[model samples]
Target: MKFLKQFGIILGVSFIGEVLKYFIPLPIPASIYGLVIMLLLLSVKIVSVEQVKDTGSYLIEIMPVMFIPAAVGLITMWSELKSLWFPLCVITVVTTVIVMAAAGRVTQFIIRMEKRQKE
Candidate 1:
């Protein structure tokens, strides 16, 4: 019953996100809106961590299973992807390096800020 309630809360938030996404003109996905709403709710203590922790943890544990369909879809399109594989790989590697560099810079900035605060 507790799990059901937690799951219901999540789904309710997601449904609100979907409604917002439908009305808004932005290109953002419903899931992103749902996540932001969930974060805000959790941050404000409107939704306690204890309320959702168990179900959230369970969802996280099974997250990889969620990607299986996407993997299979990609595999089904392999022939089309094969022609662009080289360029796709190059783009993936380049973007990954760029993201890593950006993340490192952000981390360093945050660390510096923390150090300044401590002094």
Candidate 2:
């Protein structure tokens, strides 16, 4: 009943997004486009929060489960992964460190700018 209604809204928005993708040449993912559309609808009060809250929460709860198949596929390809493990490890570590450092610097810069603005 309630679940069906919420599901219908999600489906309708997703379908609209897919239809829009055909006309738009954006490089972004269609599902992401759908999400932005949904957000815009909520912001404009075109879609009530209560209408989608239950279904949205349910989807969030099951989001991790959606990755199970991908995980299993990765596991099955473990041997191939092991062959490239060294380069992968190096790239992962270097990228992670670079990203963390950049994020921290950006945060500090933002905070300093805000303080200077306040003064």
Query: Model 2 RMSD to the real structure?
Result: 3.9
Q: What do the candidate models score in CA lDDT, each in turn?
A: 0.97, 0.94
* Regions of model 1 farther than 4 Å from truth: none
lDDT of 1 at 93: 100
Candidate 2, run of 10 with poorest lDDT? 21-30
The digit string of per-residue lDDT tens for model 2 on 1-119 reads 99999999999999888888888998777798899999999999999999999999999999999999999998999988989989989999999999999999999999999999999
lDDT string for model 1 (1-119, tens) is 99999999999999999999999989999999999999999999999999999999999999999999999999999999999999999999999999999999999999999999999
**Using alpha carbons, what is the TM-score of model 1?**
0.88
